[model samples]
Structures are given as C-alpha cells and as structure tokens.
Target: MNIIDKALNIFAPGIAAKREQARTEVVRQQAVRKVTNSLIGGVGSNGRGYGKHGASTTKSSMLFWKTPVGDADTDIHQNVPKLRERARDLHMGSDIVAAAHKGLRTNIVGTGLRLNPAFDASYLGLTKEHAETLRSSIQREWALWADTTKCDAAGLNDFYELQGLAFISTLMSGDVFALMPSKPRPWSVYDLKVNLIEADRCATPPDKVNIDRERIQSGVEVDADGMVVAYHFSNRHPGAGGYSLSGSNEWVRVNKYGKRTGRVNVLHLFEAERPGQRRGIPVIAPIIESLKQLSQYTNAELAAAVITSMYTVFITTPADDEGGTPFDGVGMDDEDLDGAEDVPGATGDEIKLGQGAIMRTDPGEDVKFADPTRPNPNYEAFVRAMLKQIAAALELPYEILTKQFTSSYSASRGALLEAWKMYRMRRAWLSKTFCQPIYEEWFVEAVSKGRIDAPGIFDDPAIFAAYTKAEWHGPSQGLLDPTKEVQAAVMRMDNNLSTGTRETAEINGGSWEDNVQQRAYEQTRLKKLGLVQAAPTVVTPSEPSNEGDEDNDDEEGGEQN
Candidate 1:
C-alpha cells in the first residue's frame, strides 16, 4: 500500500474508481451469463438441467423424454399402429394377455346378445294388442339379421360372434368398423349386410386422397367440428399380397352415411379417450413393459427349474500315464455295468458322466455329484407382487387375472365386486358405442321395410329414437351363495328397492317379459293337459292378545276364588 498506491495516485487520480468499476463490470457480466445460461438451459429446481433439445442431466432420462405430450387423437395417430402390433404379439405370446382377453370376452359378450325392446305404450298411444303385434313383428324381423348365415358373407352365424369379434378387435386394434351394405339376401328381412373391417386396411391417406381439403388424418376424415365424416380404407389389407392394375395402393372412400339419404352406413366402434379422439389406444399399452419383463422372468424361472432337476456330476482323477483318462481300466464289455456301453464316450481327457454309469477312477480320484438349488426362494413373492401391479394397471383383480383365489371369502368377494365395476363400465361403453348404434340402424331398416309397424318414424326423430330404445342382455353374474342371494333379491323386489325385470335380468340374463310370457304358455299347456299346479303356500304370523285383558282375566279368577 505504500509505494504502489502513492505512484497510482500521482499517475492516475481515477485509478481506484477504474479498478472498482472493472470489478463491478465483471460481476455484472457473470450475473448476465448466469441468467442467459438459465434461459438457454432450463435449470430445474432440483439442480438438474435440460438442454435445448430436452436432453436432461437427470439419470432417468429416456428416449421418449423429448416426446411432446399430445392430445388423445394425436397420440393415437402417432402410436396406435405400433401399440396394436405389440398388443397382438402379447395376446399371442403371453398367457396372461390371452387370459385377460378371454375373460373380457366371456364376461362381456357371454353366450349371445339378447334384445329387450322397451317401446313406450302410452307415448305411441298403442293398444295392448297392437303393441304385442309390433313387438312380435320386430322380434321376427330381428331374427333374420341375428342369424349368422344371413348376416354377413363371412358366415359369422350370429350377432354373438360379431360382438365377440368386435370386442376382441377393439381391444387388440384401436378401432373396428362395421359396414352396413345393401345386398339382397333371401334370409334377411332387409337387404342389410355387416362386414367387419380391420384397422390395418385403414392406413394413412393415399396421395390422391387430398389430405388437406379432406382433412384426413390417419385414415379418418374429420369435419370442422372434429366429427368423423368418412373413412378411407385400402381396398385390400396392407399386409395382404395383391396387385392393383393401377400400380398404386387402391383406396376406397366410405362415408359415415349414405350419400343420397344421409342414413348411417358405417359404424366405428372404439372408446374415445379424449373429446375429439379419432381412434383408440390399445388397453394393453400401459402394461406392455411390465408384461415383457414378466414373460422373461417366467421363462427364466422355468429354465432354472429344469436345470435344477438334472443331476450334475463332477469327476477328479489322479495323474496317470494315459493322460488323465478316468475310464482307463474300465472294461468296455464289463457285465457289472450292463448299460455303461449306452453312455457315449468323451474325446481325449474329457470325462462324460451319465446316470447309472460307473467310472473307474485312479485310486485317489474323487467323483462328487452336484446338488444344484435353483428357482430363487423369493420368486413366488416377487411374481405375486408384480402380478398385483399388472392387474391394477389393467383394472383387473389379481385373483381374477391369475385365476388363483388364495384369499378369504370376504377378500375374494371384495376383489370381484371391485373388478366387476370396471367390467360393467367397459360393458356399458361397448353397448353404447357398438350395440346400441347397430340396433338403432336395424330398427330404422325394419321400420322402413314395413316389417315392423311404427307411426311417425321418419317424420319425428324423437319417436324414431323411442322406437329404437332397447336393452342388451349378456351373461348373469351368478351367485356365490344362491339361497341367500335369491332371498335378498326377492326382499329387494318386495320392498320396491328393485324390480322383477332387473332381478330376472341380473340372475338369468332373461327378459322379465319373456319369462312371464313363457310362464303363461306353460300354464296354458298344463291346463290343457288337465294337470293342477301347486299353489304357493303363504304363512301369516299370529296376533298377540291385549295385556289389559290378561290382567282382567287374572283379577276375575282371583275374585271368584
């Protein structure tokens, strides 16, 4: 501070200020650099950073890190095809996947689709006789399309098969299409045919399809409101081997409705994941990684078990003049070991030991058998935990998924009840999105063909909708304790908590009206045969006497005494 400060003050009076300003500038630049770095590279609160390209400093960064979060329709357009392939592969390869599909199909579709027509008697102002006639006529007309041989050229047989196929398709692929064709068939009341189109045929729009004006994205054409207007399907499946004369992939445009009348002709069946979602994502998409890992784990366990079952022998031989051959002195024709000849000989110094074989070892040589322990002790517990997670992801109960009920009755029942909620939701979705629409279309055809009599069908949309109102019945949720469940159902009905129609449908998958009609028919037949049916016994509780009367009787008796 003595000589240098004195010289700086003499040479430059502003030297101190200049040095201070330089230091301040350096700090300011540092602050600016820090801010700029922060702006350019997104610094997270946890001290982890992400670069411009979304390359993160976090250890868990994945390839999909930069993948933008898109809406449902966008997600489907980008990922659904790959998801479909993966899901199909899983369904084919994984037992769990197959079981899930089978369970869903069985629970949702069951034996067949039963129609319960709920026509409003008062609204239509129809007499009892007229309603009966209309219902009977509708049923008869439905039978034509319900038959598998009459419905489609594929010989699907009935709507049950159609339902099962459609459900499976929707699960495997993102969507399924049902084309309503006007083909004259001898068996059908209306010249209606249903053809199921797979997702493969609905590829990206071809060059001539005009993706701009048509607003076609991923094979589906949408209007300004984002409603699907048409579907552009390849004439043949992309995987199918065929040649078009035009030397290009031929595509056909199928409108959602008939061009002339604006009547619906195509039914697209898929559960919408978003409001404007054009397609669906496979149900198995979320659990694919878990499934693959599970498959690998299962295979490894099986292989380990197989390895553990085999006996491994280790041989040690003393140094010998014959180059360490253990069977040097063992005679080939020795009768003591008759089956020793069957054991193949090893080359050079190699010793091959098999079951029921003797090896002549050099005097001090030892032969020990290895007892291998495999299939890790924690394997079952790990698998069970993993399965629980997988089941949760699929919205299924682990017991149902595994078909193993090791829990108590109450626990199992609780799991089933919880699982049924999901199943019921899916069933309702399927019914609404697929079955109801198809039924409404069928109703329209039946009314138009004069097969079923309904006034004001075309003029009044409300009446048309009312006429199409119907309920679909599937398999019943059978009782765990039949007597108790039946009694409970009866009590509910008696207390007006439920109805006979609902109870009948829940228990037997039969319409209450149909059951009543069948009962009446049976009664008529019995009466015709002069057989008396047993009447139901009614038990009434006895009334209690008044307490005052009992006291009065006792007092009178005492006075008389």
Candidate 2:
C-alpha cells in the first residue's frame, strides 16, 4: 500500500468527526439564542413579553400606537394632491407621476428564509432532479407575490379587475416563506413577505353592528361625519362575528368570521367628496388606499405611516479655506498679515461650516471674516421639527425606547441632507476655486488662436469639450466628459429656474437691452396677474345682506317652526 493512501485512510474519520462537531455547536448556539431572546420565556433581550409575562423595552416589541379611527388630528396627513400641484408648479414631477412613468422598483426586505434543520435530511432525501423541480416551484410562487409593477392609469384599472385572483395569489405566496424556527442564538434573522391589495374590493354588510352609517349622497353610504367605509365580508364566523365598534369616533371595524377562522376588516377614511361638499377636494381621504386592502388577512393592522416632506435649503456665505485667504500663500505683502492681527485665525470648524456666515468685516474690506464657527441653528431646528412632525403623525413619540430604530432612520435622513448640502457646496467651491485657472488656460489658447477678443472661451463648447476630454498619453483613454463646461453652465441655468426667476436671459445669455426688456415683461406680467402693486378692480356687491331686517328674520322663524 502507498504511504499517502494509508495516511488518508487513518485521518479521514478524525476530520469528518470534527466537521460534524462544529456543525452541532452552531445549531446549539442558534437554539440557545432564539429561545432566550423569544418573547415568551428565557433570558437576555428575548424572554420578555406575553408568553413569558415579561415586557421588552425594544421598539420591535412595543405594540403599535392605535391610530385614531377617523381623520388624523393636527392636519398631519399630507395633502398629496396639493403637494403634487406645488411640485408641478415648480416644474418637478411627483413620486406618483415618476412611478407611473417608470417601472416599480424592487428591493431586499428583511432577511430571507432559512432551512429547517429537523426537516433537512428528509428534504434532501428527494432525488436531485426532483429537488431542482421543487426549487423552481418555490421561485415561481415567490415571483407571483414579490414582483410588482407601476403602470399607467389604464394598467392600474386592469389590475383592479383581477383583484380577486391577485388577493388569493398574495396569501398563498406568504405561506411559501417558512423559515427554520430558532430557540435561541447570537443572531436571528426576521423575514417578512408583504402582500399587496387593490383599493376597492369591499361591500357593506347587511346589519349595522354599532357602526354609524351615513348616507353621504344618493346610492352612496358612508360613516357619520363623512368617512368613506370599505369592508371585506365573509360568511365564516371569525371574519363576520366578534367584531364590534369601540366608540363613535372609532373607524376601524374588525369583522371576525369565528375563532381561528378568518379576519375581515375595513379601514375608513374621510370621503373625497359628497353632496353638500365641494367636488374634487381631497377632504381627508386616504391616500395609500391599497394598504388598507392588504390588512384583510394575517395579524396586520393599520397605522398611519407618516412621511414628512422637507427641502434642504442652502445658505451661501464666504469661503474660509486657508488657500483662499488673502495672505495664506497668495503672495500678499508681509505688512498685510501684521495689520490683520486683530482678526481671529480660521479654525477647522469655521472652514467646514463656511456657508451662511455673516461677513463681520468692513463694507469696503476685501478680506471678509466669515464666522464659520457658528452654524444656522434655525435651520437645525427646522430639520428637527420636520422629524418630530413625521413621528407625531405616525402616533409615535420621540423617546429613548425606540432609540436604535429612530437613530438609524433619523441618521439616514440627516445623511441625505448632509450629502445634498455637501454636493452643492463642493460644486460651488470647485467652481470658485478652479475658474480662474481654467479661464486663464482657455484665454491663453483663445488669444493664440485669435479668438480671445469677444471672450469666446466661455461661449465655445467645442474648445471646452476638447480641453475637458484631453488626457495624458497612454494606451487607454480617460472617461472624462469633454463638454464639461457647457454641461455645467446648463445645470446652473436649470438650478436658477428651479429656485428663482423664469427669465432665461437673467441667468444665461443676455445683452443690456435684453435684460431691460425681460425685466419690463416680467413686471407687466406680474401687474396683470395682480401680483404687483396694482389695485384689484372693485365690483358692486352681488346682493346686499339683510342685517337686522324683519323680512329675513320672519323667513328663518318660519323654517324653524
């Protein structure tokens, strides 16, 4: 026998045994963690809650705040239509519009399912070819539920027609998402399969079970106080029985068919319009109506998923970089530095917080001392208010209990604003710092080419593109845009239009005459629109009010009687 063959035979059992032992250890650890952390009984962060009779401080464990039955208090829910109108006025598309135009986006939600170890061996017992077929079946089932598309109005209408089939498919898909149950371990991954529903698959039941019903219009029944009601009706007991209205103001109606049978529920929101109500006005109507339909099955309940809107406004101030300073290394005479001893040296904070600073120097002074140490506390307060409003609307208080979740979400928001600010500031800084060098190089070339007299350097897109696209000699080429200057200029024009005047000449190209004409046209238009200093034409009253008139008083008394 060969030496190698003998060695392999001798050590094979030892290696296999070690591998099996390691696998067993992993399984044990997982079991321990899941058991301990579970809400029932154990230890660590898990053992609290109903089964264990111990409550957890974690946000995930807290019962969601009950949303008020009817309209949200404090006008917290967004006026979606108005917001969209405003966006349109700003020449920007709304999210719904964008979604309708583009396709829906898919993303990873929670963790994916894990294999059940108890059934692992049996699952593996199937032939390899059969196992492949089973895996394909799972994939097909997931695709039916996980995939979504945002089509135009016509397509959405088609989906509504197929609502029943969609609903059944959604529930069946959720059952496919089973994962191995963990008792206790270091890490536990939670996965969720979300089901979507159409907005209008409901009908009112035969009897009113303490739920107030109001006839808002002919053939249209709504709850009292003008709330639109939609319900899923099931003949079974859990879905139809044991459901009762909590109070007059309560809007949630749970239709229980029977114990452990099914749950049929309806979420109510104020109707968009009714008789004695103005048409096309969004009167506290539910915006995300589809979410209500999703709650028909499972333990899911409704909560106002509040979203606060905000804009990252930039406040420009003077630059504070040492390189940009007059006497840093710009060849300022030594006497200037000596004379400026009264001024404070710029710190890192000042340099970074360079925007929105007040120039504390003299009006005639060239070297502006922008106090970079202080940031706009007002802006910070505005951001905090926006966050608080979002939380409050969601019926949640900003507390330490949900610190981890709050911090993570809040950090994301702050990070987005910070990134937006940094991007704009960086662009501005680059423009300010690099302009002269770029201009100088172009100017030199233009002069040499007999094209400098009319300042053609800024106007010639071809020349700018050439310089931008040029690269060091190598086998491969750089991917820089050759038309950088032209593109940047166009972007600046777009930015100006978004935040300022629509007069293109003021921001882009204009002669003195053109500027004058543009200003005159704008002023005339504003005056015509009653936005300028122009008095609105007074008209005679359509009808005079009968104040303290006996005739009007008699008519009112007759109607009352």
Candidate 3:
C-alpha cells in the first residue's frame, strides 16, 4: 500500500479512541465538578468558575468569581482538566461558538472564516475605498460629545460608560458584536475600538443650559420606541398549565394616523396564535391551587405538558391589530354584498366595497354586540396569561413578568413603556453575560495583529475563515488508525513471511519486504515535527533475468557430454 494509507492505519485508531474517551470523560468529570463546586464554591471542569447554581455545564451562564471570604482561600487551587464537558445544560455549545466565530471573522477580515487562503486573500485584497464603504455610518453624536467636553482621562472614562448605553441600544436590536474564546480576555480583537475624536468647538454652555441638557439627556427619550411583544404559552386548555409571558418586553413604536413617534422604531407582535400548539414548558405555580392540580403529574410529564400548552396559547391567540387595517365593514359593505353573486343583487354599480361582518363566531353561534368602543379585555387578559405561562416555563423571576406594548396603550407616545423597561433590564443582564470574558483575549489579539489602531468593527468573515483554516486545522494531525490487516498486500505478505514459505521470500518475489519499506516512508511523514527519524531501508529480492538459458538447459539434459 501507499505511504499515506500505511501511516493512517498506524495512527487513526489511537486518535479516535483518545478523542472519544476525552469527550465521555468531559461529561463525567463535569458531573463530578458540580458536586465539588457546590461544596467548595469553585468550578471543576475548566476551573473557570461554577456557573449560576453551581453547574459548569453552560459557558454563557457561567458564574463570575467573587473574592473568597475568610483565609482558607490559599488552599484552593485552580485546575484545567484536559477533558472538558462538550456541552452544558442550557449552555452555549460548539455551534454557538462557531456561529459567533463566523460572524466575528467576517466582520474583521471582510469575509467569512472558511479556513481557506484564497478566501482570505480575496477579502484582504479589497481596495481601501471599498473597505471603507462597507463600514456602517459613523455616528456623529460621539464626535460632538468629544468636542464639547474637555474631560480628562477619568472624565473620559465616565463618558465612555455613558456611550456604552448606545452599545446596549445596538445589542437589543439583536445585531450587536460579540466574540468567542471569551474567558481570560479583557477586550476582543474582533471588536472595533470606538474612538471619540475631539472636534473643534466653541465656548462652554452656561449653568442653566447645562442643567437643561442633563435633564434632557437623562429623560426616557433614548428608549426604543419599537417593541417586539412575544407571547409564550402552553398547550394546555387552562389551569396551572396555562401560563404565558411576554417575550418581547421591549420598545415598539407608536403611530398616530400613520405618523410615527417615540425613540424606538418598530412593533413586532409575535404570538402562538394556534390551538394545541406548545411554545414553552409550563411551570409549577407555588400557589395552593396550582400545586394541588400539579400533584397529578410528575415533573418530567408536567414539563412536557407545559411546553405543549404554551404552544397552544401561542397558536390560538388572535393576531395583534397593531398594523392591521381597520375592518369597519359590517354595515358599510351592505351595498357590495347586495350586488354580489352570493347575495341576490339589487344593483352592481351602487355596491360599496370594504370590510365584512364583525360578529364573534362560536360553535353554532354568532354573538353580535352593539358596542365596539373598547378592546375586549378578556382577550387582553388571555394574552397576559400566555406570557405568564412562558415565564413559568422558563422559571423566570416575578419581576420579569409578562408585559405588552400597544400603540393605543402608550397614548400615542409609544406602546412600549413596560417593554422598553424590560428591554433595558434584559440588555444589562445579557451584556454582563456576554462581555467580561471576551474583552481580555480580544485586547491581546488585537495588539498582536497591529489592529489596535484600527476602527471599531467586526472582523471580516472571509479573511477570518482563511486565517483559522491555516492556523487551526492546517497544523492539526488528521485522525488515524493502525491495524495489522490494513491492506491486501500487507496481509498476503504477513501470511507468506509467517509461514516461512519460499513463495514471496524467494529472490524473485519479496512483497512483504516491499511493504515494510512503504510503511517506513509513511512513518516519517506522520510523526510530529522533529519527532521522526530517517526511514530505514528494506531490501527486496531482485527479479530474475534470462542469461545463456538455452545453452545451459541443453547441456544439463545431455549429461555433461
């Protein structure tokens, strides 16, 4: 067999076995670490730290370290176990890291991170003008701030903190920059550094003007007007299983006669508007009524049912009319219906076209009401219940309860009062969850790459992909396996050699001998750098050649005459 095949056969199995063992051990070790961390207030698997509730299963949900209390801290040691659990309970995994990595790579390198040199070169080769053009519009507000304020480094730091609020604004929109390999990092190389260049400005403002400016800036003006109201509910019909929560507790816009107002922009009303569709798991309400009913189901069964019931609520809920056309047609479209084919027509030309009837439909009944002055409170309550159910399923705190934002509810200022508040809170929590670990590594990488002076932006994916490919897997050894019965020729040679038969071992056919030489060649290539020795020579029997064949044969037959 060729050198490649021989080498693969020799090493593949061991690598595979090692990888599998590592994976299994990681999980097993993580389980053990939880017990350790709970007892000792430390993380076990990666030695990073215990996550919330003392589980090292989730990286995103990892708990930040607190300075240990008392003097026993000296004995506590940090460890990095070779085998780390591959996944965590409700924790970030390889997929998440890969995705985050992909995004960052693309942003930094001007292309996706595909691990290809050609891709990287193509992206990096972009003209200066083109690269600059792709960057998002530089916000002028920061420039104004730097120019207006004559602050020292300390004051500048405070200003930066305030400006970070803008980053939160970006995060809540679900498109903020994030990094991977986050822990042990203080800043991300992938993150673009936001520079506040001081601009030439006039004299300082008076005291009265400064106070007014502070009040204006501090007002709720910066909150998002746009909101996404997501309703999470269970598949259950009612009772404890029927809980719902508002998923989109963020700002949504307000529209007055088609004119928009408020700091936030849009309104998204997402609901599981279907029957029997489960969107989230149900929660066991500690209330006596809920607990009594929940006693019938086990935790596993209840969790499943809760999930199903939430889907039901989401699917069954009616569409939010935030962007809906006003359907005012019941009496107004009488003329059109009169002339329509379904109804015996009186006059086609006199028919008016608009909305249809507004009667509520039930099984074998249509309930008609004279008044349509206000929204059905019962329906609103149903929506609230759906959101509450989601919170229950997720085991969220009461403070994180469900809320709704409606253009009508905001008195035309904006519909997202509660949503805006929730978004701010969620952003803060999520930021803490996202930022700390990433910053450290990012800064080092950036400094090394000479990108410290570069503007703040995500790495381009294309270049990042190329770099990763060259750096990570390029040098990594491929999986290999070694077995005695790897090739047909090897097996045959082994048989001939072991039998001590003259068939191949004879001067004319040394197949086994040739295989040994091939194997040696492959061994050198497969070995780690500077680890392999020179390939040993394996001598093979030379092929026979006919020389004076006829004369010799004739002489032997003639009996030496």
Candidate 4:
C-alpha cells in the first residue's frame, strides 16, 4: 500500500492539471458551438426558419417533419414510375389537366415547329444572296424529309405531328426517348427516321454495373462527371400485358451518340430542374394534388346538381295504415316498384318523376321532397381560386389557362402577354431539346448523302454549327384585338425595334418575303388588267375644293335677286 500510494501522489498534480484543462476545452467548444449556431441559424425544429413559430415544438402548426438530405436522382428514381402513371391517369380524367395538355400542344407545337434555316452568312464567308440561296435549297430538302411518313420509324406520323405527340408525351411521362435509326426505304430518299418511346422503357438494367468511373441512374448511364454516356431501353414497354414478367426483362443498351460520327443516336428528352436530377418530374407534378381535389369537387357538384334536378320524394307510411299514395290513388304496387329504375345515387331506392306531376301523400303518411341544396354557391369561386393556384404552378395565367377572358381588354391583353412569355420560353426549349437535335441529325445525313449543300460541315465543328444555324417557327400567338395589336406591331417596326420579317413571322406566322412577293404579283396582275391601284387621297377640312359648287352659286344668286 505504501509503495503504490507513492506513485499516485507523484502523478496527482499532473492528472489534476490535465483534467482541468480538458474541462476548460469542453466548455470552450460548447460556447463556440452556441455562438456559431446563433450566427448561422439556431436549430430549426420543424420548418423553414429558426425564429418565431418555426422552432416551436409544441405548436400545432409546426409539424416537425425530419427530412434527411437526398440527391435528386435517388428521389426521382423511386417516384417517377408512380408519378408517371398518376399523371397519365389524371390527364385522361381531369378536365383541367387535359385542357392544360391541349393548350400546351397547341401553343408550343401548333401545326409544327417548322424549320427556318438561318445560315450564319458572316461565319460562312458568304454574301446575303448566296446564303439565302443555300438556305432555300436546304429548306426544300428538309421539307422532303420531314413532311413524309418516311421521317417516322413506324411509317406513320410525319415530323410535324411527331412534335406535338412528343411534347405531350414528355409532359405526360416526365421524360421520353427517341431513337434515330437509319432505314433505307425504296419510297424515300432520306434514311433518317425518328422513333419515340415512353419513359418506362428507359430503366436501369437488372445487373447493375456500378464501376468507380461509371454508374447507371435509373436508365441513364453517366460517367464520373455526371455526363450521360448511354441509355438502357427495353425491347417492349415495361408495362405491356403479359402473364409472365419475363417479357419485360430484356434490355437494350444504346450509346448516347455514335462513336464514329459523334452524331446523336438516342435523344433523351426531359426538363431537369435540379443540378443532379437524372430524370424529369412530370409537368403536372406540382398541381397533381390540387387538380385531383378540384376534379373530385367538380364531380361532386355536378352529381349533386343532377340529383337535385331529378324529382324524388320520400313517402313515409304510418304503422297502422298501409295504403295507396294520394296522387296515384293506388296502393304501392309490385309492378310499379319493379319497373321504376333506381335513383342515380347511393339511395338504393326506386324513384320516378313526371313532367308536371303533383304528389299528395296519404293523410297518415308524410311526404318530404328530396331537396339537396346543391349547385353550391361557392363552387365557381372555389374552383377559380384553385385554378389560379394551379395556373401559377403551370406558369400560365388563370384567364389564359381557363380561356375565360371576361376581364377588361387591358386585363385580357396583360394575361395574354404574360402567357405568351411562358409559351415562347417553352417553345424555345422544345425547339432545342426535341426539334433542333432531330434537325441536326437529319442534316448530317443530308450532307453525307449530298441532298443538302453544306460544304465543309463534315470537316469543322464550327462550320457545321454555322450551316445548321436555324430558327423554329411555331403557330402565332393569336391576336385578341387585331386592330390594336396590329398597330402596336406597326409602331414597333417603325421604331426599328422590330423588323418586317419578325413582325410578319410573329404576328401572323407568315414570311415577310412571301407576303411581299404575293403582293407584288397581285399588283402586276392589276396593272395588266388596266386596274392600277391608286394611292388613297386625303383632304383637310380647312382646305376648299378645286371646283366651286354650282348649286351654291345658284342659291346665292336667287337670294340676291
């Protein structure tokens, strides 16, 4: 005991000093943590903010949902299929969703996104005349390829119709894929064709190859840098009707681009918002819940109105007296009950009504007409409010989305202007993601086949870009008030803020060149017919006519005599 006690006594002073220092360090860390947490934002208990009710644990409004951080690919991979199915179901059922998709198709891809070849003349070292000639040649050839069934893989829809279908399909299924496979048909000169498939077909293969440098997210295979390298597709739709699941198992892996040509092979079309989002969320995702509720509310109101209109009366009989209804003057008959159809609701009873019939219950019996205070007074208001929110989420105005322009001209015009802004943005996106890429791939083949005059395109990337410089023209934004809108367009042109080419193209979806040429032809024809059009004469009220009026002179002479 004495020997051990000596060692403990010797190290006691050092041990005490170390313990105090450790305690002081712990206190310092706690103090620093408190300062940093306060400076940044103290622990937010349930919501967006650390202040006020956001951190209140006991408040009913504070749900205290604890969500851990997750990547977009992980999230999208789990929910996209269900979301796609729900979105498709809603599109078929919900009037609002159907209308949105309808308007989207019309606005974004009306007629079609026609290719307007705008050759970069400056970059190509060509004069305006030369560039325009080349553009015309390429456009004519493009029309030959895009306007026929030859452009489609299935030999059905033309490129123009495919635009609308593809756009709607993307919005429906969150994403869509297009495989540009070449097939030489005896009827067609161009071998390029477009084939579209739903997003379901594009999915991760069963045996996942997760290497250090490459991995597959859902169906998209990406490199270490997150650049899409390839896409995996199933031969048949994953949801095709099959008793055995084996039919949906086989997958085809397609590279994103042809290795030799560096031309686009598979086009994966989607609208990814987040940085790491491997797939798209459906366009109707944000409004899904609201739209579903609104659809149900609308249906409920409609049914209630119909039932209210259908005349039904409840006849209660006394226990002592079981007799005929007063009006019919006949006892409740088996045939009448059997013949009567069930009421159009969950009443599980037979009821009928005549055009101008009166019901008189027996003295002992009581009668109560079914009075469902329906056609709810707040139905329109509630629907409109919900639609406004839905429209906001869809980046459209309530008036534009619903096509109810009961508002003033200014308000209607303002809504159209705002809506057109979104439409234009969407049109641009479609042009880039869907239309332009297809055009480029088609153009590549056209160049190789000597159908298009794109010299030096194969040699230089910059040259290819210059030759492929183009503009996509969709349907015009219809004018609400033609007079005012036309005048505005005129003013814009006069001020040099816009050009005649642009004004004609935007306002009427017509080419300025074509309009001018047609007008000139008409004028020349009029001259030949000796019916030359004259300039309209204008006279000021202050100025007198060149010839004096004979009636005025005669009246003056008579008055003088």
Evaluate model 2: give its lDDT.
0.31
Residues 1-561, candidate 3: write the lDDT tens digits. 466546656878676556668879999998997877667656544445444345655445554644454321111111101001111111132232233223222222221111111123344564556433322111122222222222112234322342343232222221122212112213221322322211000011222234533122201111133222221112221122333222322222222112341111211111122332111111111222332232323343544544333221111222346443333333444544443232135354432321341222222323332333233335445434543554444333222332221212112112223333433343334333322212223333453556432222235444444332221011111111112112323445666753322223221223333466687777776684556566655534334433223345444332222
What's the C-alpha lDDT at position 379 in model 4?
85
TM-score of each predicted structure versus truth: 0.78, 0.19, 0.17, 0.82
lDDT of each: 0.74, 0.31, 0.30, 0.78
Per-residue lDDT of candidate 1, residues 282-305 (tens digit):
778888989989999999889767
Q: Candidate 3, after superposition: displacement of residue 77 in Å?
A: 22
Residue 141 displacement in candidate 4 (angstroms): 0.9
Candidate order, lDDT descending = 4, 1, 2, 3
Which candidate model has the greater TM-score, 1 or 2?
A: 1
What lDDT score goes with residue 344 in model 2?
40
**lDDT, candidate 3, residue 6?**
62
Whole-model lDDT, candidate 4? Answer: 0.78
Scored by lDDT, the top model is 4
How many backbone overlaps does candidate 4 show? 0
Candidate 2 per-residue lDDT over residues 81-103, each given as its tens digit: 34323323222222322221121
Judged by whole-model lDDT over C-alpha atoms, candidate 1 comes out at 0.74
